[model samples]
Target: MFEYISSLWSQFLSLLSSFNISSALDVLLVSFIIFSGIKLIRETRAEQLVKGIILLLGIWIVANIFSMNMMKTILSYFFNFSVIALLIIFQPEIRRALEQMGRNNFGKKLGLLNKEEEKQKEKKQRCISAVVDSAAYLQERKTGALMVIERETKLGDIINTGTVVDAIPSQQLICNIFFNKAPLHDGAMVIRDGMVYAAGCILPLTKSNKVSLELGTRHRAAIGMSENSDAVIVIVSEETGQISMALNGVLTRNYTRETLQNALEEYLSSSSEPKTQKKIPSFRKAKKS
Candidate 1:
């Protein structure tokens, strides 16, 4: 046994010695590919399927070594067809992975240049101003309104629940929607890409224990929607005529027009701004409250 192992070790050393720089590089590249592929499949639903495939391959290797013809033949046939089967089973995840890779590449190409970032900041300010003005108008008129601003996460599913208007956002349009006699008075409005995408959209209600009883269904819905997506929700109470804002499931109440505008700018702005600017006034002081 010692002599046999010595011979095998000698053969391995000889093979290694014969490998040139290109051959060594090829081995390294292949190893990296396998390692990355394994890592990508791990912790996913694909992991179990991959394990099954590996188990079958192991069994086939053992069968071949033992000269078990039938077992080897069956395993080989299953292995031959597994490529198509795996693709079918993991299609969605595969597509998502590819899409993520494409986005990463695209984002790298866009390289956060200062000018482009400044333009985005400007656009966000415009949107914030529009929303704040609308909220102030609605609060004064006692017009109940729910406005959701989309953030990082896509609100495609939520947006589908409402009518798709895709109109340019304005204070007048928003106030009209929540007016006493308007058809969409009861439903929430969704804003995306600085546009009012839809109105009369129903939002989910929050079930959190931390929510205050002072909040109505509209406020609760705003909080609920924010909890699910990174959306900013502005609520104008119909009964109290107070303006409030919700983000990350937390509701801040009694926002004055000036404070509301500053808060919107602060929250929506991509760059660092003064923290003091975001502070909202006490709700109790507001006449609407």
Candidate 2:
């Protein structure tokens, strides 16, 4: 038994010796792609699909080792055919992932160059302040409002869906638009670069059944928008006068004025956003869980 262990160790050392820096980088690249794909589909219907595939693979491995020839053949054929089926089944998810990739800055900061970063930071702070103040005012009046603040992802598609306001963001403007009797009260308002860029925009509704039935259209739309883009969505409950923010498919509730302000600042700021974006590792996912 000791000799057998010694032989195994020798083979492991040989394998390690055969690997170079290029092999290490190759593994890292593959790992990053897998991680990014999982992150794109996290908390969506596609996550369940991935989980099912993992279970099937586990069963196939067991069946193959047990000499279950019929089961192995069936499983092999299923996997081979499922490639096309998965593409069809997950078409929406695939499109969304590709769209998100196109939206990213190619792992490079195009808009956030270090030279002008300080100026941009000040602007981002002002934007966060305006949004938080407006949200607080809306929350106080129970004036139902849904606002999407664009971050790294360009929301040109979403912006074109609404009436272009192109006015500076202000507490009064936000409160007035969300008033029950206002013209655009039924739709969402979008803020970009500290400006009320658009209003009366339509956002997609979340298809996941995991959301609570108690959450209304505003919250559903917020979640849906967050799922589609890397935007921070603020929602004020008309019925309960509660404030909530949705990001990356997660809905957080019961935010006070100060807490909400801090959250927006932390999330909207260039530095804080990177912490959330670095989900390319299992350790980070485990930490979040």
lDDT of 1 by residue, 1-289 (tens): 9999999999999998999999989999999878867766655557777788788889999999999999999988887898898889778457545543442335534566688767766667777888889888878778888999886557788878878878877788888888879888778888887788888888988755555676678888987776555577888999988888877556777888888887676666643323432211112322232
Q: What is the TM-score of each candidate against the true structure?
A: 0.56, 0.72
Worst 10 residues of 1 by lDDT: 278-287
What does the lDDT come to for candidate 2?
0.80
Q: What's the distance in Å from true for residue 141, model 2? A: 1.6
Clashes in model 2: which pairs?
none
lDDT of 2 by residue, 1-289 (tens): 9999999999999989999999899999999999987777776678898899999999999998899999999999999899798999899788777866666554455444675777766777777877788888888778888999988678888888889998877777888888899888888898887788899999988787877878899888988888777788988899998888888777878888788887787787643344544322111111211
With candidate 2 superimposed using the best TM-score fit, by how many Å does residue 14's alpha carbon deviate from the native?
Answer: 8.9
Cα misplacement distance, residue 216 of candidate 2 (Å): 0.9
TM-score of 1: 0.56
List RMSD in Å for every model shown: 9.8, 5.9
